[model samples]
Target chain A: MDQFLQLIVAGLATGAIYALAAIGFTLVWQTSQTINFAQGEFVMLPAILVLTAAHLGLPMGVAFIVGSVAFVLLFGFGFKRFLVEPMQRHGVLPLAIATMALSVLIKEAAKNGFSAEAQPFPSLVPDGSVSVLGAAVSVRDIAIFVVAIAAILGLQAFITHTRTGRTMQATAQNPTVARILGVPVERMILLTFLINAALALIASYLISPVYLAKFSNGETIGLAAFIAAIVGGFNQIRGALAGGFLIGLIDNLAAAYVSSAYRTAVPLVVLVVVILVKPEGLLGRKEERTV
Target chain B: MLFKTMAAAIALTAAMTVSAVAGTVKLIDVIELSGPGAPAGTNWKNGSDLAVAEINAKGGILGQQIELIHYDSQTNPGATRAAVQRAVDEDAYVVLGPIFSGPISASMQITQRAGVPQIVGGEAAAFTRQGNNYIFRTSLNQADSMPKLANYLRDEVKAKSVAVVWINNDFGKGGRDSMIPELQKRGIQVAADIATESGQADFAADAIKVKNANADAVFVYLNEEESARFLRAARQQGIAKPIIGETTLLGAKVIELAGEAANGVKGHVGLLVDAPKPTLVEFGKKYAAKYGFTSDHNGIKGYTAVYTVKAITERIGKLDREAFAKALHGARIDVAQEPGILIDTKWTATGDVDRESFLIEIVNGKPVVKATLPMINP
Candidate 1:
């Protein structure tokens, strides 16, 4: 029973991180009809940048701020102007292909520009765990879970409650109609990208202590996030949240209970079953999507 | 006129080749210099550079100057294959390493086809079993090393049951597959057999599983970084059972990364810098002076591999690839005879080298050698 609860808590903590990344991916998709395939890589750079800054003798707080701003300017804004803006004109296929390539570019650049070695990151909380009903859970894991929930709540409120958030939703529904209604579709799109970048940075920061700052880490995290988005139903904030936790829980439970070799495969099988049952995803609605 | 032109070209080729051999025997060092394998590859290269400089200072291998060329494998199997092919085409006297198992497995056949002696740092069991006489290892294969590890677990640790947590890759899987049976031979039960991902971040689930297994000890078979991560996770979860592992778990990188979490963890290390030997201690100091870092087992493998080439060449009294390959098979080089090889070493018929290895415990972020296990054949 203790072991089972341990797996559950650990899974939920990991799932929260996945959910955060999935939310950013969903936001970008909703705002601009652009699937930033480099979503995992988006999270990877800030973590690496922060670690690099920290290694070079900067205070942790200063490093985090400096790394985040640089990451936003380089990958978020610059990527928007140069690559995403230019390629988005070609078609969804071309844009998706370009982002995938950008993912590799970012990964290689991180390796060559910095070091390929995995660097340890300090935990946010003091190194100790509290007994949650008999299972020993790390203080850092609990902190990560709490922070993710807080961020998710804040973002959900911003998306639904604020005027700009509703306007952004209006743009997601129909860009032409939103533009005609005096909403700057382009500005809304840029805001969504920036917001997504911020979420990505937060997710990276939370998870880096667990995963370490590795150049190749984004691939698995990105893959799991995409699965979560698809499973929970894309374009729905709550759905992405549910999807992330579900995948995380299932993945961890499977690893703990079943063969660890099938850790990745089990979740994928669950995803296939979910897809078979509901093509639109658990929380997703039927929408006009490009074939 | 055409025949005369061909004859002239052939004569020029012969002259160039003769001069190349007479002046300097070309040895290509093809290893991972970048990417994920950079930590291992770069160390191996630095070790070779150190060995090459020493050998040259001592008037080269059999008085013929050693021309060592470093080729980067980039840590990719495809790149390794290409590098080996290029090395063979260059008429290399010997080809040394692309350390990790996957790259070596992909490229060793190229050198085998060319009948060039290729000394590798790869520890997978399958590399030696491939019937490629040209392929040799600077370290013990999984088959040779696992038995010794299993022996220590059974005889010294007195483990009745063990939990084997391994990374799901060539290196980890190979070690686990070889090790489990050895444990069983000593009548030790495997309480849990857990396989893990290569770069898995969260080991909470894995740790929980091991803790639940409630085994006598946990054998962590993973790459260096993963070992550290597992150690941290294990410590955080407070898994009080003894954690045992092989060389990678005792690596300096693992200890550094794991920090306080690494304390009291014991493992068998095949080539440790901390071993109480004058030669190893001296090599470690010289390597640190040159590279501004401590040399790990991979560095020793790289350094020792070059000296092995020199020793074999000197024995043959000429730089001969086929003869060198034949000589290294089932060969024994005593440390008294050739101190450059560092350890008194013996090679099996299948090209797997055997030597003394140390069992060490990490104390305050340094490996303290507790026991030295002699070579099975020795």
Candidate 2:
């Protein structure tokens, strides 16, 4: 029972990271109707940026701020203005393809421009363990779980209650109608991209300490988050969060009980089953035939 | 008389030009410089350059200046194959790396076919078993090192059941494969055997499983970075079992990254800086003076490999590729013959090397040598 509790807590903590990463990926797809394939690279950029800044003799806080400004301008505003906007004209698929190209380009740039060696990140949470039901759970894991739940709550409150969030949702649903209703549709879309960039930075800061920061980390985290978004439902923020936790929990349980080599296979099999059975995902909204 | 004298002067100048141009011998270095292997690859590259510089300063190898050219393997097997082909195409006298077993396996066949000697730093058990006569290793392969490690597990630790957590790559898989049978031979029970991916982030589950297995000791077979993550995770989970691994786990990078977590972990070190040898002590100091950071096992591998080539060439009395390969079938290059060889190293017919290695424990973030195991052949 003690061992089981440890696995559960660890699994949930892993899920929290996936949940945070999934939100960013889902946010971009929700507003732009295009999945930013480089969602994982966005998570990597901030960690590298901070590392570079620290190497150049800047304080950690200052380096983080510098990294934030750079990430927002380059990924949020510039990405939507240049890559997504230009590519969205052809089709959503083309925009997705462009994001993938951006992922490859960013990966190479990070590998060559920065160091390829992995470095331990300066974690926000204190380094210690907390005994939860005799499991001795890491303090970092609790922080990550709290942050993920908070993000989900914040998303619900903002989209339902706030003016700008409603406007952003209106634009995602129908840009033509939103623009006719005197909404600045382009600005709202840019806001979504900016929100995604912020989420990526947060995810990087949290996960880097556990995983270590390196150039190639995007593939593992990025692919998992992409799957989480699909499993949770692309249309709903809460679904994405739930999807992240589900994948993390499944991954941990599978590895603990089954063979570690086949641990990754279990989540994938669940994803396939979800796709075959639900088509709209476990929490995805089904299209009504009323029209 | 004037016509004959002018012709003689022209002939003299032509002969002098030929001597000047022909006084160079080229060796191509194919190493992982830009990818996952960068950490180990960079150290090997630096050590190779240091040896080249030292040899050139002492009037060159066999009186010809060493022309060392480097090509990036990108830590990919295909890239390594391409790099080796490029080296062969350029008519290199030798090829120096692609340290990872996967890349070295992809590349060694090219050098074998080309009849060019290639010295590698890969330590997988299957490294020298592929019938490639021209390829040689500068360190102990898993086949030789695992038995020593198993002995340590049996004699030193007195552990009956040992769990093995290994990476699922060429290097890690080979180590795990070699270790299991060796443990069986020594009557040690195999506990939880867990396989992990390269660059995998989360290890809490792995830690939980290893702890739950209740094994007497844990054998971690992974790259340096992954080992550090595992070390920290194990410590965080309060795993107090004696964890053992090869040089990769006990290496400088793993120690630095693992910090307080790496303390007291035991491993069989093949080529480390703290081997309790005067030559190694000197080499480590010199390497630090030249390169700022401490030299890891890869650096020692790269440094000794250069001297092996020079010593073999000198013993053969010529630089013929075929002769050099033939002479190295059963060659012993002692430190007396070449101080740069560092220790007495013997090469088998299949290109595997036998040398002195150390059993070490990481104490306070340093590799403290516990015992020196002499050459198996000796």
Candidate 3:
């Protein structure tokens, strides 16, 4: 029982980090209708930036914020120039290739520029573990989980309340109609790229301490995010959260109940079953496709 | 007619002389000068450069300066094979490392058929004793080292219940496979042996399993990247048992990534302390001055490999591959490359070398030399 509760806490905390990464993936997919395979690279920005800042002896917080905002803009501009422009003329395949290429480029650049060695993010939370029930939970895990939940809620509020968010949604619903209604489709698409990049940075900042900031961590995180996006239905924001938590739960539970060797494999199995049952995802709505 | 024939003979003699000195030995160093997961603070580039530099500075071997041709393999196996082939095509007399087990294994066949003496810098046990005289390593093989790991767990730490976590690659798999049988023989109860993917960032699930298994110690075998992440995740999940494994964890990244959590982890590595070897101290001081950081296992391995080549080359006095290979076997040199000051024996066999891996534990957040365990076989 105690062990079970421990697994749940550990899984939920990890699930939150995956949720943030998945949300970024979903945003790019929903707005652009093309997956930015480099979405994980955007997520690794803050950690790299922080590392760079640490090398320069800048304060951790300042370095993180500057790095996060700078990368968000850089990635946003890249999407606008490379992905959106190419997709407007040619097709989505080019955009996919471009994003994957970007992923490789960004990974190599980070390794060469920031030093490929794994560097720790300076700890923000106090080093302590609190006993909840019989399971001991580290302060860092709790902080990460709380930050993830807060970010998700904040994003939900932004989408529901903000004019730009609604305009972005309007653009997603019908790009032609949204343009007819004076919604800047190009600008909204750019905004989506920025949002995805920013969210990815946020996720990196939260997760780097828990998982050492690796040069190729983006690929690892990206794969989990892809799994989450698929399980949650790429079109549904709530689906991402659901998918992330479900995958995380299955990962932990499987390790405990089954075999640790299949920790990653088991979650994938559950995701496949869920996808089979509901092709639209757990909370996703069916969308009409254009021929 | 006599005058024309004398002119032709003089020209022919000049051509023949030019071709004779072409016997100058060209040794190719296929080492990784830069790549991901390289050892911390290692000057492999400089170490490699210094070997050639010293050899050239001392004057040409057989009237030809040893030419060191280097190509970065990026520690990839495919790249390594290509690099080896390039070296062979370039007519290199001998080839030295593109470190990392996979690359070393991949390039073994290429060098063997070409009769090029390939001095590798990795210790994966599966890589050794390939039934070819061409493949040789100064680094200790897994079969030779892993039994010592099991012995350390039983005798040094007195660990009873042990859980093993490793990457599924040849390096990790070899270590895990060798240790398990030996560990069982020591009457140690094996707990959970969890395998994780190489280059993975999140290891929370694996950490939980280790915690749940309640093992007294966790033996983790992975490259630097995954090992560092695993340590951080294990700490976050509150799974604290003295983590010990391969020498790769002694890198700066591992210590930096794990930070406070890296305090007590133990690992196996070549002895780094200063001993009677005058060259080692001189090399150490020079390396620190050149690279602006302290040396790691790779620096020593690279330095020692060059020294071994020099010793063997000096003994043979000629660039014969078969002769050099024969000299490498159990050839003893008393010069100090590592602390405790003894080469004691030259690598007479692929399985045994004059190498000793000292037990290292993190003391004060740094890898301090612990007790030295003599080679079980060598």
Candidate 4:
């Protein structure tokens, strides 16, 4: 049915955003063995910064690039260096708590510095809809889907083909052994954070136009992405991507077909079912530790 | 020696009475002045502040200067509760706000227990139904407003089939509950009833469902940001049905956020800055000059609340909580603060004001008044 097709298109577009956000979480977790609870804050920060830059008279394109790069250095690099690096030596719990604190700090800072009112962010694509297979789809939605898919594919290629990417993967697998084998484990971890931050900015740029850029949006996007990562496979990038799409699809389908009142509960249900059935997640490999 | 001691005791008692008579009457405002709700909260504060300033300049209430003490709720219920306790501890003559419904509901218990008169502008119908005598709402309740909205949809817009999309909160649910039955009464079929989370960004799924239902009009009940987002999403998905929304969509935030996409959407608005009334125009100009921005419905409600309290206090000639509550319970006073918007400020037994609701359509990024719906009891 045309209605079903419409829901599918919308679902795919929404899923792409979740996929990018989940990728941000999975990347940091894989490299550092620590979940960046603030991954959602990263999605909000760059969009707000870019909006601020644009308001300050910078060209939109220039503002986007500058905002993304500045936030990566300040928050991404600064967080890893100042908060994560120091607390990581103590324990994973401390590091995770630090990330949670970082998220709150970022959210509060944005609320105070920027207006609490949700501001309109300019879309990358033009404003219009096209009939695709009898379902009307917004140009922005299509652009988001294409861009997100391309970014994921590009990341896949980078990990498979590049020496630095392979070295980063090796570091993620076993930092101690990777370091002993001459891999720069510290640098790889930092690079992973940078990548995660970049991915978050990309997702923000895609989604902000639809959602409107607000400081509180971080929690909504962050929680969904966290759920996606956990449900897909917290340690696997591909699994996280698949999990993100699954959530996006289910959320939309549930709202369309079932009760919209229970749409928000769908993701939590998936998370609970996944946790109960397979603690390692659908695609996660069980850890084999030697005593 | 006995006569001298008796005279001294009388003198001390006389001094205490004189000091009490000359003391300033303090009104406490427990409202969100920070966090996400800050913009509206600031407007409310400014409105009340302006009213107090004007009242003091003319002459103090009952010859005693009025002092307003504002405690930030920070959009949290715990903070609101703490603020209410602070107001009680300060021995405030009356308390003004906690703008959002949830905070107002949470703080109502404290105010009721303390027996402090609390006047709120939140639109939740449940705020009045709690059987609390001290709680008064100055804004239009959904019970009174939504039926008029449904009437407009039936008579003016002439839509037969309607799709209802509302945020799943007290305010939204109240609107939805009141609206559905009203529509049914008029023989308008509700094709789809969709509930959305507050602050939800993506509305494609919801929009798609509404589109699929193929209703003549879509009625939306959401906050400012969510309304803007939904409007944008719906328009983008090529759903061109007539969209009728609650007052939240007619706000400046919705215009700024939704841009051109907001055009053609009609809704019920409590206050319009461009209303052709001389008093309202003057108030708008004064408010803009003072606050450095245009005032919204919240500001108007806040401004009117102060005058309402002033009216009550002037009638009683003192700050007696019980007397003030009794006076406000079915009293009608002509609100002089913002005349046209909230003119005949009549309170029902349940403390809801009998105020007119105006219909507005967004045109060229501004709300243009279409029709005025007189207050009708639900």
- Highest DockQ, which number? 4
Worst 10-residue lDDT window for candidate 1 chain B reads: B12-21
- If the candidates were sorted by their lDDT against the true structure, best first, what order would they fall in? 2, 1, 4, 3
As a TM-score, model 3 comes out at 0.88
Residue ranges of candidate 1 with Cα displaced over 4 Å: A55-61, A180-185, A289-291, B1-22, B33-36, B56-59, B63-65, B71-79, B334-339
Residue B171 of model 1: what lDDT?
79
Winning candidate number (TM-score): 2
* Model 3: per-residue Cα lDDT over A231-289, one tens digit each: 88888889988887777777777766776566778868877897789888887789887
Please list all clashing residue pairs in model 2, or write none if there are none.
Answer: none
Q: What class would a CAPRI assessor give candidate 2's docking?
A: medium
Q: Model 2, A1-291: lDDT tens per residue?
A: 878888877778878778878888778877777788898898888898888888789999999889888988999899989998888899889899999999999988888888777877787877667788766776767788888677667877887799998998899888899999999988899988888887888888878877778888898788888788889887778878888999998888887888667777888888898889987777878745442
Write down the RMSD of all candidates, one decimal each.
3.5, 5.3, 5.0, 4.1
Interface RMSD, all candidates in order, equals 2.0, 2.0, 3.1, 2.0
Model 1: C-alpha RMSD to truth? 3.5
Give me the iRMSD of candidate 2, please.
2.0
Give the Cα lDDT of each candidate. 0.85, 0.85, 0.73, 0.83
- In candidate 4, stretches whose alpha carbon ends up further than 4 angstroms from where it belongs are A54-62, B1-22, B34-39, B56-60, B74-79, B129-131, B290-292, B335-342, B375-378
Local lDDT at B283 for model 2: 89
What DockQ class does candidate 3 belong to?
acceptable
Q: Candidate 1 residues B267-349, lDDT tens each?
A: 88899778888788889999999988788898999999999998888887766677889999988987788887888889989
lDDT of 2 by residue, B214-315 (tens): 999999998877898888888767788999999999988788777778999998998888888888888899999998878889898889988888888878
Residue B241 accuracy (lDDT) in model 2: 91
Q: Estimate each model's TM-score.
A: 0.91, 0.92, 0.88, 0.91
